[model samples]
Target: MSWADKPNGNDMARRAGASRSDFDGDFAALRQRGRHLIAEIVRLSRQLTDLQQAIGSRRGAPGRGSVSGGEPR
Candidate 1:
């Protein structure tokens, strides 16, 4: 029978040197890192939204000066 006949046929790479356990460990580490990065992105997005809203409110105020001086566009 061919080596490909087994369930873990494609796992010959492990026999060569790297084991399936090693692959699993690496995958787990990477998954955890990805989760952390996603959380950070979400936090930063909220902060950015808050800053934009604050700026928008200030600009909409009557007293705040516009980029085009005091005159109307």
Candidate 2:
């Protein structure tokens, strides 16, 4: 059966047995939480890119090799 036509509260733990209003509230809360998480991920990705660029610049200079000087440690 379709979503609306199906019985409320399936085998899931959600207010599955609750009314449509309850289900809508739950869905809205989940959507908001997902949006917040996505924003956090984007922020973290920008920070990670900045860190990588900093590392690249630091290592780009010559004579930045290990103290072992190409010989196996």
Candidate 3:
């Protein structure tokens, strides 16, 4: 029939001997890992933003060209 119906029929055929409890446990574990990864990404993004701002401010400060204060060689 249609493409969508093919996959559904295939899934039904595959699940005939599969254990439901095992599938449920695997799904739950995957969901937990996904959430942990998202939190880590947010933390790293904030740290990167803070570091960029610090670098920009340092570069914009006055007397940045003066190393030891004798007109920079």
Candidate 4:
């Protein structure tokens, strides 16, 4: 393209600034979403750990009879 077809320096600067603003906005939104997902993961992990512990308590402690092999001698 001819030089005249190219944007002037001021126009180019404005466009660059706008593009940078868009990127910054997008990154901010992404970071917020990441934080939300991390919180959700932590909450779910805690719930699962609580459930596992509850189930384990109901099953009683492991004993020789609970082993995979036949009854202990």
Please name the candidate that would achieve the greatest lDDT relative to the true structure: 1
- Candidate 4 or 2, higher lDDT: 2
lDDT values of the candidates? 0.64, 0.63, 0.62, 0.62
User: What local lDDT does model 2 show for residue 12?
Assistant: 73
TM-score of each: 0.60, 0.61, 0.57, 0.58
Residue 66's lDDT in candidate 4: 26
Question: Candidate 1: TM-score?
Answer: 0.60
lDDT of 3 at 65: 30
Off by over 4 Å in 1: 1-15, 61-73
**Between 2 and 3, whose TM-score is larger?**
2
Off by over 4 Å in 3: 1-17, 61-73
Q: Is candidate 1 or candidate 2 better by lDDT?
A: 1
Residue pairs clashing in model 3 are none
> Cα deviation in Å at residue 70, candidate 2?
14
Which lDDT tens digits does candidate 2 get at residues 1-73? Answer: 4345644555475554568987687688768878998999999988876766555556662433333234342
Please give the lDDT score for candidate 4.
0.62
Model 1 C-alpha lDDT per residue in residues 1-73, reported as the tens digit of each score: 5323534736676558877797787668668878998999999988876766665566674543334434343
Report the Cα lDDT for candidate 1. 0.64
- How well is each residue in 1-73 modelled by candidate 3, as lDDT tens digits? 5223434424766678769885687568668878988999999988876766665556563432322333222
Q: Measured by TM-score, how close is model 3 to the native structure?
A: 0.57
The C-alpha local distance difference test score for the whole of candidate 3 amounts to 0.62
Worst 10 residues of 1 by lDDT: 64-73
The order of the candidates by lDDT, greatest first, is 1, 2, 4, 3
For all candidates, the clash counts are 0, 1, 0, 0
lDDT of 2 at 73: 27
